[model samples]
Target: MMEADILIENCSEIHTLKGPDRPRRGDEMQDTSKIKNGALAVKGESILAVGSDKEIKRDVEAEKIIDASGKTVIPGFVDPHTHLIYSGSREDELAMKIQGKTYMEILEEGGGILRTVRATRKASKQRLLEESKARMDRMLAHGTTTAEAKSGYGLDKKNEIKCLEVIDELDKSHDLDLIPTYLGAHSLPPEFERSEDYIDYCIEDVLPEIADKDLAEYCDVFCEKGVFDVEESRRLLKKAKQFGLKARVHADEIENIGCSKMAAELDAISAEHLVKTDEEDIIMMAESGTIGILLPGTPFMLMEEKYAPARQMIENGMAIALATDLNPNCWTESMQMVITLACLQMKMTPSEALTAATFNSARALDRPDIGSLEKGKKADFLVLDIPNIDHLPYRFGVNLVEKVYKRGEKV
Candidate 1:
């Protein structure tokens, strides 16, 4: 018998999400590559074998075996966009939003992102690390093995580096794999006279330090109206590229001002929050191989009526991904809830939502090894109490993840 580290046998169902190595698009997104009575053998951190129960039992032996007889198995969720390393909650803003104050109006009154920045700046690294660690635990409990965490609340050079340092520490300390992103351009800092000046400071001061320390894999900008415009965003992203960091953008969330088009032009890995993206830009993004990362939970939490045009984007051959946008503003670490919001509010199918949350989300982060449950991929998966995949988004408002595994070890 071929020995392995762990064997999960007699699974009721497995949504392998095994298909092309690239992200799914158009008709391809419907294919979930499901297997019945499946079994998986893991060796160290990578999948050794995946097949029917009888086939795996005949082919392999394991040091430890798990009988998932009545459980469903799937690749661990990948959250490509999040601001999870922050100081405090924004519940006060929630009350204002509930009372019919618009997002921009609140921002003008200094009660949105800036409020969180104030708290985060005042917080010590140890406190930030503890809070971020707690959030990472919540993400793990929700079945997310890999998540992208951004540093933006620390808008200045010192505090921005401090936030990224905390994120790096959390990455080393937590079980969840945290992908760090430098989002110093998340907003115009209060000290800056103009948004351009803030963008210049990030490029001139922060980007060099981030590159020197190798703190982040990606550099992101909030390319929205009353924020960094498309031209300024391009300049910052271009400078970040020179430092060997990939580009990602918060594109077209509040207004359709061609941020999606700009993302395509920059060949960014992903464009997020395309709530107002036009059809031309949609086609452009699809053609440019840029993934569209949609955060339905943001709109849901804001009580906004217009969700992203996910159906249209999928129909137009765009590779779509879903994330919680987990922040003090959205306040959710549950990708399961994001799936539900994608289906019920964004009108995505269960299969599409699952694919978006898993495979496509990994692709958004440019991670090829962690999204699927194939033979060569990392053995990060979830055992669910449900019978089938549809039950996850169907039975919302509850945690269905029975257990989580990372690198072949149960966490």
Candidate 2:
């Protein structure tokens, strides 16, 4: 046989969360196995073998050898929930939050998601694409290789299609594995301030066109107090599924209104922002196989008291994921900062946090092959300048990623 195309050798540590394994019910969290001083073999765009340096060395002859002598290696981070394509910033809203204004209060003042909706609807696709591309570049530098981007800033039909088209163009033009989600029900558009009219417009007018175009892999609804409620969100997502899109939800970020339970009942791919969900909802999500995407950054940026019950979810056997929730209104697109917040605020172990960012994040997008380092998986991974994997979250407020590889090629 021909030689392997590339070999990465002399790794100080290789943290591999190499399983899509679900633990038996009533057990501790799924455990990941690590290989110390590891080496991995790659051919073309796929991992061929991963083991100790000696083992991998004996197994393959390689045309190109990468000396990862001083670096820690881990699969690239996957951010599975973000609204990175939106226009405008909520800096004014941020200031209001500092003055003790709640998220609901700001939304009531037409200053939260709707503010972004107005700005995005006004901007051209070229502008949105350029801005979103720059944001993705920043995220890539932080070692995010696969990301799920939402089209929530455009709540109407034409603008929703505009946002998804931008996402599609970015995916075609960039190395990042961009998973697109249609979020036409993010909030009530200014034109249709009434909830029922907005819901009708989303389900009857907007979703049909989006579905006909086959532009998105999943459909999402924001099931919150001021946004689409549980019943309305369910109706929208139910209709979205008829168009052959998987379901996802923005649920219970600021209130415990059974959005999580609805997500479970609807069998959503993932439920995001469970800041106000309770133990029963967590169990429901776990039982329903819906990944919990916790966005602590949003709560932090909004200056809110509530955060997702990550520990409770973990203990309850739920697969927990952490994402930037990158958007104009909440978080900026910085996966490193999000990880730090996961550890400090979400109370995840360093290992668990890394797993959440990498493998579980891919799971959040319903993508199995891009998250872990393994044979037959995509050759996407990152090298850290930090001395150890623990430093990724331990050394807070630092840029530890040194290099990123997508499809076996450095970017």
Number of the predicted model whose lDDT against the real structure is largest:
1
Supply candidate 2's per-residue lDDT for 223.
89
Q: Candidate 1 lDDT, tens digit per residue, 281-368?
A: 9999999999999999999988889999999999999999999899999999999999999999988998899899999999999999
Q: What is the C-alpha RMSD of each candidate to the true structure, in Å?
A: 1.1, 2.0
The lDDT per prediction is 0.93, 0.84
Candidate 2 segments whose C-alpha is farther than 4 A from its true place: 20-30, 101-110
Q: Report lDDT (Cα) of residue 312, candidate 1.
A: 96
Model 2 poorest 10 in a row by lDDT: 22-31
TM-scores, one per candidate: 0.98, 0.95
Which candidate comes out best when scored by TM-score? Answer: 1
